[model samples]
Target chain A: MKRSVLPTIAHRLAILCYIAFALFPLFWLLKVSVTPNDLLYSEGVRLWPSRTTWDHYAFVLQHSAFPTFFKNSVIVAASTAVVVTICASLSGYALSRFSFRAKYLIVALMLLTQMFPLVMLVAPIFKILSPLGLTNSLTGLVIVYTAFNVPFATFLMQSFFDGIPKDLEEAAMIDGATKFIAFRQIILPLTLPGIAATLGFVFTAAWSELLFALMLINGNSAATFPVGLLTFVSKFSVDFGQMMAAGVMALIPAALFFLLIQRYLVQGLTAGAVKG
Target chain B: MRKPWLKRLAHASEPWLYSAPSLILIIAVMLVPLVVGISYAFRDIQLLNPFSGGFIGIEHFRDLAKDAAFYTALKNTLWWTGASVILQFFFGLFLALLLDKPFWGRGLVQALVFLPWAVPSFLAGLNWAWLFNPVIGPIPHWLFALGLMDQPGNILSDPRHAMWGPIVANVWWGIPFFAITLLAALQAIPRDLYEAASIDGANWFQRFRSITLPFLAPTIAITVLLRTVWISNFADLIVVMTGGGPADRTQIVASYIFTQAFKRLDFGYASAIALVLLVLLLVYSMLIILLRQTLLNKD
Candidate 1:
């Protein structure tokens, strides 16, 4: 029952290779962003530059619309995540603890929302929102993103809720607390990890949403990071260094949230997989 | 005795009360727009033209049926979706299996490998686009060094191979999704079965072939189905990278619909194209479900 030395070496090496492949592009992105303008074309494609500077980062941070874009993206993504999690927690709670006639229909409807090309909704959504003064507003983006994320977050939260024993809530119910109070007091506290995971997931999802932002919002004032970066890219097609610097900045929050919550994500996912 | 009927009504209404807020939002945002979007497929609904909301039946469909770009896009959609899903799934499965084994620094490695999934799709596209560029990027030079191309050139602008650029970006960005899910499924697998199999002298490959694959099958099925639908409808990468350019070679149905709506400002035509794509996807999903049903029945 002894494992071979060569096989273990191979396994370790393979994992390292996968990690390298996953990280190399991002590495190159960071690499190019710091290389000076002079060395950029001359020492082009070098793994590392002989000389590096923070000029691009400085310019992006100090003299660009990136701060505004960052603000807008934060507003849109955070608001969407918060709103979606609230709705999903309620819906997920309902699905987990209740017996209702429309349960199957509700599930099916949520699934149906997942299926269609959201691009189809573009025109109609724009049409519907234009009159309400919602178009070109962050609120509109939040509303659209909340609806899109609620279904998946509900499913995710439902799995986490399912993992908690029913007796935890039932016991609370029998102790004379209302179901709402029991859920708020007993259940929500236990699902903090799941809630964190959902918030992180929805934040990243909403952060990366580009098409709707592009379709619905316009002008520089309200542009999210994606739209802002896109416009920045097209506007300064020659300035690769600055653009990559901005890209690096955009990666910060989502990556931090992801690194923190990924363990919980896998945990929640395993719970769901077990149920399946 | 208490009124049991009133209590029963309260019990029945409670869950709905909990669920009502989400249901209301979905109906307003998703459901209503969906119906309006479907109706837009038949009616003229130009964004610019205030006079364009007239009902025109099947005209957009008829135009779409005849358009040659739509046909090319259909073909590209198949190739794009098929290659992306297949590559993402296999690599994801391999990575999941690799990580499932105990190793030192596994926690760090797991975080590193999954980092790409956190990168915004637009940034992923832009990052790869820069990578494929001849100036200030390493990928083309690497390809040149390997003699894969005559010169360090941008494949993103090459009509023959532009599709691969975005496909590669997509595969990289999407791999962790499958990996994370598959790894969860792998972990969900009870370890005792493997221990029992090994006690009977089964090798690793045999144990995996018989036990791991079967355990992973259901998760694999559902994840793959969901991913296929999701990726087929995903247009961000293509839209950002190629803009569905190099003469529409990379234009999938989703991006094509986006272009029709966003650029042309033709909501009616875009909705029509979206409707057709929706119908096709529904049929594909039904077929998969039925196929699984038959396979299950046979089992």
Candidate 2:
């Protein structure tokens, strides 16, 4: 049915308000990132900068340790995303398709894993890892992030697997293909959207993870972007321009990653919303 | 018959093989750590000498029972979860309803509203920190200019308002997830039901009450449950904003656990607090599941 004009206008207005509220911080981030350092204090709450400069960006990139942090963040997030997706895909398919004897128990246990606060597990995890010489390293962060992220990602992938018809894989299996072959050849290709979604989800999660990185990595050498941002805050004065610039810069990889995977993200969101 | 029996056996065995890799990984990575965490809760194991502790039994639990910080953290956690989840869900549903109607620019508007979820939580927190800063932050400046606040440092630095500052930031970040999920549910309602209601002379409110609310109940409950769990466990925003200070006023259980473990180096005591947190979450989950089952059975 066609909506009336009045309600349509109201709906548009409401949505516009919501959009403005959501995007205001991001717009502010960009606004402050380019505002000249002198204008930052004196602009007196202006929406747009009177004069714009790339000094903050240049300083963060060339003068600060942000470049190193950005590289480390990319390496850690990409590695964690790749590793978790691989592990979650294998496991998610099993959870979706199988009915083994301990399947219920395993599923319950996995759900249980998600229940406890990550902070609660930090000490024990540190204890476990510190003995293995895993602390204060990028590899440790990746491993920890991968371990923490896998359960949720597996559940995400499992739902996607459930959405796909099993008949396609069964048909492949019936044609004399081994189960792994069917999974690799037929099922995996269909689950690309799910894989992409999982990758994007896990990548951003690891990319922005701060608590573990703060606790586990003590020095500037192995810091992720979040920890690196803290360096902008010294004992006395906070550098607003530099911090905002770094914050804006940090958005780039995540934005690019999402841009690449948005097609799948949209598909994944709408997947089970309605019957075909 | 022999061939068919062999095929049945293979089918039965295949699931085990398929599930083994994940099960093993979960057990090694998650289950073992959990078990170790529980045991460590009963000890006085300091980080400096983790293995040097004897089983102190219920002493840690007893100590926690008397600790004022534990109580404060527990109270703050309840407030954070209750307020954040309820507000996020209400605003999310409101926005979802507004967007449910077809209008120009709906797609672009939806994309913009959902952008917060795309942004990293850390960055979101940092952005809000800047926004709430007393001197340089625009929010206090605007509030002062508008005469809403007598001075600049009222919101961010005050013990009373610091928690709410982070809560607002979190609600900003969380609203999009709820909106998207609830919007999906709203769109899934059969159009024919509304048509039937209108045909029966029901007005918009009546139709929404009779149809939309009931249908959306399950999705709403699940969403709230998920959000409750997530918001309760949320420590990052608080860590970034206040670090559980001016006087440990904003310390939730997660941040409390973090402080105990990392800052104090009292791993055993932290483990105890962690166990308390685990038990609390277990009870909450069980309660939600039971409620869900009851609701489902009624349906």
Candidate 3:
């Protein structure tokens, strides 16, 4: 079939427009972060400033508590991702493979978790964690994030597991391997893409979470990126350059992780949405 | 003692063992807190006041009944969720369709367009907030240049238009999600079906209506339903951008709950508000499910 040139051009233009819309804000973010403070107001609407400096980034990294926030966020988000992925993998494997008594109940509970406002749990969780001394701790953030993420990650991993043929594991089991061994040695190798996707998803989620972090963590010592940045914003509202620099730094890890796993995420989402 | 009963029991319990850790976490962190949170709604549980953890009955709810701020927030939640979801869905659907047809550099374009989703919600809020800031951001200047306003000013500070700031940010961040999902569903539609439709003299819109719509109906329904519920509960943008400010114009139930708990340290009142939001969401979900059921039954 011969495609019309006009339609093709129009389609390309539309895609370009969408791409620009998506990237413009991020571009502006980068733009303002590097612009010299003296020129910020004068060249407010310029697509690109004639001259730019990295002083803002330097100041944020050197003079601010952002490094601590960055490290804390890495610890919390990485720990939560690892823990959530482990729990999700096991539970997801069961849901994909087994016909158990509590299967429906488990599904129902997970769905219920998704349905309600997570904000509802804030007060109770704080109250519960305070006595245990988990508040203001990275471990507490990890635990809460792990639980909040597991349900969706389980669903995601389940869909990926479903994509793999059951015959592969069945064959392993027939060779005198326990079901667990078969799953470990045979199935897991096949689901590496899924695992990567889940890790990325949960990592991004834990990284970006704002309210709970704001509520639980108190001082700059324990504050995650969101909390620290927000505090910085409120305190130094006029330091747009430094704030944008911090924001740009925060975007790096999540964006890199996302670009890596987005393919599998879309694939898994399709499998779950289409087949289920 | 290699007993058959023991083996049978282990076989039956295998899945449970595998699921136990996650189950324990969920019960401990989410389920227990949920129950305790519900209990909190019926009691007085201020964080600062040592004498405030008493049973308060429905007094909080009675106060909620007359709270003008609560009503504004409730109304804003509907508007925020509705506008954000609809805008995201349509723009997302358009982008998905555009990407569905293979093009030069499609992979690169897809990644570029979906990059916004990777941004932390807080960062997205702050980024948009910066854009709307008149001093450093360009949006206000653009709006002014277009004669939409008399001078460059922060939209985030304008009570009448404050909600749109977050809504716009949300749409930008959320569009990629719908696009990715819808694009997947679009690709799943059989190519031959489109060929046959075209051969039968059906035009693009007809093909879309008859073929694409049906293929995408289930996904559309599910995503829309889920997004509506999720977006209503999403308050990070509002909190970060406006803090529900300009006299609480952009406050939603979720942000209102946060305000009560975090700022006021009124855990009980926050829980009370959260409980009401939860109930309203449950009703909304039930209605959607019932509507889906009746539609299925009709067919």
Stretches of model 3 off by over 4 angstroms after superposition = A1-4, A96-101, A159-196, A262-276, B1-8, B184-218, B291-299
Candidate 1's C-alpha runs over 4 A off are A1-4, A93-101, A158-196, A263-276, B196-202, B209-211, B291-299
Fraction of the true interface contacts (Cα pairs closer than 8 Å across chains) found in each model: 0.72, 0.53, 0.76
Q: Which tens-of-lDDT digit does each residue in B117-197 have in candidate 1?
A: 889998999888888989867888889999999998999999999999999999999998888767756765677899999
CAPRI docking class of candidate 1: medium
Which stretches of model 2 miss by more than 4 angstroms? Answer: A1-3, A93-101, A130-137, A158-197, A218-222, A234-237, A263-275, B1-6, B48-54, B96-108, B144-148, B183-219
lDDT of 1 by residue, A242-274 (tens): 988999999988877777776665455445445
For each candidate, what is the lDDT?
0.87, 0.79, 0.86
TM-score of each: 0.90, 0.86, 0.88
What TM-score does chain B of candidate 1 reach? Answer: 0.93
The docking quality of candidate 3, as DockQ, is: 0.56
Residue-by-residue lDDT tens digits, candidate 3, A34-69: 999999989988989989999999999999899899
Candidate 2 residue pairs that clash: none
Ranking by TM-score: 1, 3, 2
Report how far off residue A173 is in candidate 2 (Å): 7.9
- TM-score (0 to 1) of chain B, per candidate? 0.93, 0.90, 0.91
